[model samples]
Target: MRPNHSPEYVQSDNSLDVAPPYFFPNVDVQGFVIEADLKAVQKYCDDFLNLGTREERGFEYRAVPAWPFAQLLFLHYPVMISAAPDVVKGGNGRDSENPIPSSNPDFIVPMADRGTTSQNEVFAAIPVMRYGVGPKGLLVESELEWILPFIVVDQPWSCVCGREMLGLGKMMSRIDIGPGYLPGSFLGEVHMPGWDGNSPEMQHDLPFLYVQTGPALPTFRATEPLKSLATAFQAKPVRWALEKIAGLSNFVDDASLGLVPTTMQTVALKQYRDAVDPECAVYQALVGCRSKYSEISNLDFYDERDIWVMFNYVGSFREAVDVILGDELKKPLVVYPELDKTVSITGRMAKVVGAFKFSANVDFDDMRVLHEFDIRKDRKEGGHGQVLKRGSSDLTARWFRPLKGFFGPRPMP
Candidate 1:
């Protein structure tokens, strides 16, 4: 039998610099697991993830909400490269330009070089609900898949490739990770393009997110009694490793080491708006992406410390923050004095559940189109608007109608 080898999509013309199979070698990553509002996550799944599959296409991708938690990843790549099909197809000849220039829309910014270094990224991953559209539209429960609801990068190449190639919705932003205002603590902040409280255009300078971890604690000291006690409840490996490593018992119980070189199945909503019709999308679908990490080293887990996370609600980022942390009970952190009184900065801060840091080689590949939205014709015919319409009375108002004589206004008596 002959093996099949063909590029899925070729760089026929002056397209993007790289296609698929993005490689980020020796990536330094800081991961934080945050306790999220389940209701908000469910609503996010319904509106963002399930909108294309269930509402638009009339298929269901329900939110499982098994775990009410979200992942905040801060990645710094020492060297980043991708598989360039254009160069492979003999487009970069001796006479051809060394780095082909991409002239696209205003939003599509081309990267200077295909293989670049010092690329930084910060993203939020939410637990995707379990739903499957199998053969003949059969529903099947699948394993947990995560969705990148919010992500920002410092490189234009990363932004372009992420959005155009993988539907990652990567936005260009400035990220800072280092010593925080607190003594001996770590801080990570993202200042992306957003609008002021009242502005027509988006201001390119505004801090939208901030993550501060508690003071650094030693590995052995932090994990000793915690890991020893946790062995009784769960994480049986801790007890086993402790038993085996008699002399090195104190250091063997690092539970965070088990997560090194992780593999994550991520999903994104890929959509392109119609150039002519602003209300319609020419193409929209859910894209499934897989990222594999290997050659892991220097893994540090900080489960003992707490993470302080704040999401600033500015411009388009408000909806993204609302999806993860519901606006049920939020306390104001930063407030400015207005004309009459003080106004809090519109945002929410989440209590950190756990955090960890690691370095590894990351590979991004395996793109799959899970489900596509309905076509224009199908949408107009089969969508909810075309179905039967119904109305309901306000029950609360109706119940108070009879009490108008006693409690309600009777000629202002």
Candidate 2:
């Protein structure tokens, strides 16, 4: 239940003297300095800040199409940490209704995550996507959230037959990439708000699309919008979560080579479909892009189809983009979010809940309150805070901060 964080992790290069009297006149999280390891975040910020110039979109990460999205998996990041056990123990066998984390490669802590202010809810991840150019800057989409769900096993290997991890029902969906953004959009958008107008990284760019589960969307569309069948199943993991991950690990090796034949299920799907039509394929080839199928296939499922169609559709759709790109429809540049190595440094890789940069501009009240403007519309332990969107002109803006910039569209069910 304790936070899996350390003082060294807190030592950030961006660490302002929030330690007291000398902090910014109206700085947010005043007095409390960011982790001293602010350099990771600072570098991440700087890279994007210099987005869209000769070195970026024009040349691509390494002069490759999908490289931007996949290449940045080498940066150091300080992410939020959480345990997969907490997610499983938080509810029934299939009730993976946990709030989405703000970042990836984060640590999930049970009791220590409480936050009286938005800034207190910091998470971690190496921002892998490059900001690209778009209509205004980068074409920011709606909200789409993603979450990885699983139940670990003590010793059972996931690749075994009939293992929940190896079968069809062992996965969950968290975020969905939308239609507009290409693979390199993240870096493209960096220049939108006049983002480093003359940075070397800037060039024509492509952006990846995804739905945001910004904690504000009315409903989640990534899955089959949980059924209204009014049926409650047992809470035990008939199929363990970790078992499935092990199974999936064997399927694909590189994220860019597309998904590999890992489990009997995915393997079977490929086989069966191929058998049915030696040429025409139903399950499209997995794009080297980092879609969630790799993550979803590892969850323990209650209702199998919900997760199935979600990933199936997402992968298929992204494949279509490849087809478009092949037609010489190549945008000036494209970017997909990549995970920097700020991970590996953490204990056991964990879920990211939040991450921020520059400084959070929260307003304190006369009573030194985080905010006097709004209340947590619905406070459910382990559930989620009613998060506001990036540009929601509503009252929720003051209640939450848009650290992720509300990119892509909201996820579909």
Candidate 3:
């Protein structure tokens, strides 16, 4: 065998960036639950998260609409930072002094004067169905899995690191949030670089997304310490009521399915476009990641009547939003009454099912490759779309070895 390469030696001089096991110590989140059209959600899952055929196993990943709604969440980090502990102790062949770039604070955005403004992001979480065949040839659906189709972040470093490292497809945008636009409420807008006309010369920053929190009704704030935002909104009665409104009361279980609790589990499509052929992908994969929150406090719920969420049909962003949510700008379920003469809502506003806010210590870790797409042929055209099977499970004993004893006998190698 050839001599093992030194960890201190740069793996690739062309790409010298942060390595994974990323962590975020502080994260403030504001979430809004929107009742979405079921058909739209289904189409999105089929188009993006569809797991193609495996000729040998005779089993493939499939997506069905779990719930007819989406979660629009805004995350603002007060002291945004990243660290790579694996490289610091010289575990991966690198010396302690020659650590990865992430050993230093790769991205640091100090809290603004008013708080929650330095690093901001807005994303939509529409849970797609993940099912597999069981031993008895029965389909078992995993409700905990979902796909994140849309996300925009302000920090450039965050955008690069998130996409390259964790497979978080984050776009660069100017995200503004917090009070001032609406009294006793929060307002958020995502300004992305796009064109007003048909040419690149017209490209400029345009606010295509708008979300405003109306003042909540005199609801009591839960002071008790909580685990996550999902737990805070885990009231069965409320969830069941919302499900009933969506005509899913009969199909869903009262205990689960309606409102997923804590540790948000999600999947993302990570891909790199070919340098020679922009249409073809060099590498593509479906990555599974979990966002677990701890030390959650100051959880407060809002009356649905008080929250407003809307998306614009910009030519650039419509392909992404409309493919999932339908023609939002032209078609709308409810039209807001003419309150401000200047403001005209051409796009659609989602029916707010639930709204909440909380503070927590979030960790953006726990990620692994769930599936990888064959990039030889174009997947979009329905060609060579099989998933590459892994030879063995990707687990290291140093971490999970202790827990193995707690379980039954280990599997024979």
Which is the leading candidate under TM-score? 1
What local lDDT score does residue 269 receive in model 1, on the 0 to 100 scale? 76
lDDT of 2 at 256: 11
| Model 1 lDDT on a 0 to 1 scale | 0.61
C-alpha RMSD values across all candidates: 15.7, 27.5, 8.9
Over all chains combined, what TM-score does candidate 3 have?
Answer: 0.69
Candidate 3 lDDT by residue in tens digits, 1-413: 21253244333223424555445655777878877666666566666656455432223344454567777888888765444443222333334685334444332221111122248888888766554345422222233466677889988767876787678888888898887354557778777887544656767786667788765433333354544333444465654454344223223224334442346667777778878778767776767777766655444455566667876655576666664466544454343332232554445566677776656677667677666665544555756545432221222222344666565586554
Highest lDDT scorer: 1
List clashing residue pairs in candidate 3.
329-347
**Candidate 3 weakest lDDT stretch, 10 residues:** 108-117
Ten residues in sequence with the least summed lDDT for candidate 2: 184-193
* Per-residue lDDT over 1-413 for candidate 1, one digit per residue giving the tens place of the 0 to 100 score: 11143343444335644667777788888877777787887776677666633423434544555667777888888888764333333332323553333432222222324446567899888766544345423323244567777889998877888888788889999998877665545778888877765667746687788787665444324544554221232234543453344223124324333222266667777888777666666676777777876666554455434566777765667777877777665666453212122444554677666666656788888676666655453443335443222211111122343664685456532
CA lDDT scores, all candidates in order: 0.61, 0.21, 0.58
What lDDT is reached at residue 93 by model 1? 33
Candidate 2 versus the native: TM-score? Answer: 0.17
What is the alpha-carbon lDDT for the whole of candidate 3?
0.58
